[model samples]
Each structure stands twice: as structure tokens, then as C-alpha cells.
Target: MSILVDKNTRLLVQGITGNEGDFHTRQMVAYGTKVVAGVTPGKGGEWVLNGKIPVFDSIRLAVNARGANVSVIFVPARFAADAMFESADAGIPLIVCITEGIPVQDMMRVRNYLDQKGVRLVGPNCPGLLTPGEAKVGIIPGDIAIPGNVGVVSRSGTLTYEILYALKQENMGVSTCVGIGGDPVNGTNFVDCLEMFEEDPNTEQVVLIGEIGGSEEEKAAEFIADRMTKPIAGFIAGQTAPPGKRMGHAGAIIEGGSGLAADKIGALEMAGVQVAQHPEEIPGMLK
Candidate 1:
């Protein structure tokens, strides 16, 4: 019923011994994500979360021994990209990197490698994706999401949470929610998530949570105009963003008439998308 993951997903954590990794790994397990294995390099053979999960030294070992189909990275910023590469090379089909602050150049290389290897990479600086009641792969709080028909793709972490909460308030549960990160060069974008949602029969509609920076919203608008058949409710953050000021990220900086809230809003409206002015308005738009 989800885009990228489901109950059959064999999950593993790459930095499972670290504080963030250890905590979320247990959370994911408790949420019934089928967390089968974990990787912590030198801390192989150690048990995390009271010996319920087995840890390995490398992703290859986790995949080979435990059949880890998906790898979620909670490594530090400097090693996040390498962790992603290791996952792909180890034959994991889906890689989700929850680590923030990874260098853009490193992501660029990871993207290239992923393209060649035909792997799906979710985020380097994101909250990650969830399939609602079926499965959760990253740091998104599992309790807030319910099983439903709406699909969500967002760039901002806090904004994603807000929109999801609004949807839940309306009793509209999501089929999938993907946080594609706010970085300029991330593994996935709005377009990629849109295509997947469009093809998923469980997803009846979509909500795009975009920000003020980057032409991603414009590009997503173009894709929706030309290809998508599902109804989409779109929201672009940073309406109050200062002009000539970068509201959110390096990629969010407004310059030379690009990445403006007005322009993105205009594009989405032109492409037949219903635009929400605020998070509270998003649930109404989806209806």
C-alpha cells in the first residue's frame, strides 16, 4: 500500500551502535518494521536494544548473512555518503540516509553511483519515509501516521510533520510520506516521489510540501502538468521569507528572481495544482 516500503521489507541499520541509530533502531523495531540486522563496523557481533538485533561490521555481512533488503543510515555527516555507497554495493535495493549535513559533493558522487547500480536513495538530511501502519524506515514518529489513501512528499522536516498532523486531523491517512531532504543535491526529489505515488494504486491523491528555495517545485509542477493523473494539493513554505534572503538552506537562497515563493506558487497554480496557503489549509485542499 506504500510507495517504497512495506511489511516484507527486511530492514537493517548502518550506524546501529551510535546514539541516534540505537534509539531509532529500537523505535523502528517497536513499530513493527521487521528490523532484522544492524551494522556498526568494528562493533560487529555486539547486540543492540538488549540483544534483540544482531550487529555486523559491514553492510555486505549484514546483507549476506541476514538478508537485509533495506539499509537506513544514521552515521555522522562525513561518513553518511560512504554508508550509502556501502549499502548499494552490498545489494540493498533501498537506502535511506537520515544523517544530516553530508557534503553536497559527496552526495553527488553517491547519486552517480546509485544511478549506475539502480538503487533508490531517500535522504541525506531528512526525516525519512514511512508507509504508515505497514512500515517505517527513518526517524518519523510512527504514532502520528495512520493507514489511508493520501501520499505525501516533502522537503522540510518540521513542515512535513505539521502537514502530516493536519492530514491526520482531517482523518486522511497517508499511503506514503517521503522526506526528500532540503539539500541542493539529494538522492530523491519531488518528481521521483510523484511518479511513484502516481503509479501506486493505493494512493488516490498527493500532497507536495515544498519550500521557498530551489526550482524543485517548478520542476514538479511541470511533471504533474504533463504526466501525473492523480489529484495533488501543493504547499510552498516561506511565504513570509525575506526577499533576497535564504529562508531555509543553501539551496533555499533567493537570487535573481529564482526560488521565490511567488514564482513557485504561480507555477503550481498554473499546472492545475490546488495550492494551500498554510499547513492548516492543506487538509482542506486535499479534500
Candidate 2:
């Protein structure tokens, strides 16, 4: 069984009328996810995407009327934290924040509030999570993935796609692939997803696609070294990124010598995880 979502997951799209919202919402609905309702504040009385799903004014109304337990936020960055808190207050069990550009301070505050309220958050600036051949919660390219025994967790969106493509080239498929977001302060971390994968019966091996960022990877290595029973292969991106400058990922910045690619690679290697020097080498390491 997959963690977080399954065939029974009922989803709600916040900002379902926006370009990003409408596009991914249609894809998700077509992929067999139960998108029960949507929310767009003043656009409550209006319909979205040919009126396929009902749109409401707030998370409270959406959850109250449609039993929406999971929410995917496509709202803009400035309002993402507010959306998250709204979902939390509405008692939504799972909230995926797909919006990018949310300030770090705002994320910290939101995270703290979520922790206090016991809410599960997936991303702040992420591609989102997918249970292959099942429900998808974010913006990941669903076409590239197929359901199988391998589980994947990544920080970078495009890099997750690259790793999945590589695995597919090797005739391997994924049980689940989670883009846990590239934000410094996110709801789920590598270790959190790893624990979920470890308990998932369908997953045989795991792939961690990370990038130069906070000490999250290093912390995950320590956790894996001590607790994980599954074989893990890892690849850290941004090897060529200039120091102190953010790479393609918002969280991929080197500060105080902490978030260097080499450092994360070393930590993973020391934890007995196979480290892929190049992205292409990941599938080989997994095999």
C-alpha cells in the first residue's frame, strides 16, 4: 500500500481556475484521482474546466460540502502559507503546496503552525508526490512514470524525472515517486518519505534524488545508516553550481559550507548508500 494517498483519496484543487491549477487538475482527474471539489475565494460561484468539479469559496466550505480530505494548492507564492494554514484549520489530513517563491520565513511560520496542529504537509515549492499508476498530488510529469517495485524520493523536480527516465530505460518501474519539494522548510523530508517507503510492501529498493541544500540529506543519511533496511541508491545534483548562488532549485544554495553537493554525497556514502557520481549512473547503482 502507498503512504499518504491511494485509490480512496478525495482531492480538492485550490485555485483550480488558474492556468497551473486547471492544467494539472485535469491531468490528475484523468489519471484516476478523485478531484471532488475546488476553491478560488471570489470565484466560488463560478465553474472551472467545463464545470467538471464544484468550486467553493474556502477550504472550510470545500471540506464541509465535498468531504475533501486532501488539498493541492496552486495559489501564488505570497498566499501559499495562508492557503496551507486554511487547509490545516479546515482539518484536511494532507495538504500539498505546489506554489513556488514563498518566503523562507513564511514557510517556517507555517511549518510551526502545522506541527502544532498535527497536519501533514507535502510541499511548499515542489513537484508533489505520486503513487504510480494511482493518485498524483502535484505537478510531476505523470507520463514518464510507471508502477512497479522501486520507490523514489527527490528534492529536485526535473532531476526526479531524469532519474525515473533512467530507471525506466533499465526496464525498472516505480511503486511511488515523491518530489518532497526543494524548499528549506518543507513538510516532508527525505527521512520522512524513506520511513514511509520502508513500510510500503510494494517497494523493493529506493532511490533518493537530492541536491545541494540544507542538512536534510545529511540528517537523512544518519537516519538511514541507523534504521533503514532497504537498499538505497542516491544522486546529489548541482555539482557544478557556483558557491553561494542558488542553482535551479530554490533551496540549492551553499551557505556556511553546508549545502555543497560533495558534502551530501560524502554523507550518503558514509552511510553505506550507493552514490551516483553522475545522473546517468543512478540506474546502474540501483541494479
Error of 1 at 185 (Å): 0.3
Q: Superposing every Cα of model 2 onto the true structure, what RMSD results?
A: 1.1
Relative to the true structure, how large is the alpha-carbon lDDT of every model?
0.89, 0.88
Per-structure clash totals for the candidates: 0, 0
Model 2 stretches with alpha carbons more than 4 Å out: none
State the TM-score for model 1.
0.97
As for candidate 1, its clashing pairs are none
Residue-by-residue lDDT tens digits, candidate 2, 1-287: 77787788999999898899999999998888999999998888777768779899999998989998899999999888899999999999889888988999999999999999999999888888788788998888877888888899988888889888878878888888888898888998999999988999988899998898798999989999998999999989888888889876678899887799899999999999999888898888775
After superposing candidate 1 on the true structure, give the runs of residues whose Cα lies further than 4 Å from its correct spot.
243-246
Write one digit per residue (lDDT tens) for candidate 1, span 23-112: 998889889999999999899988888888999999998888899888899999988888988889888998998888888899889999
Backbone clash tally for model 2? Answer: 0
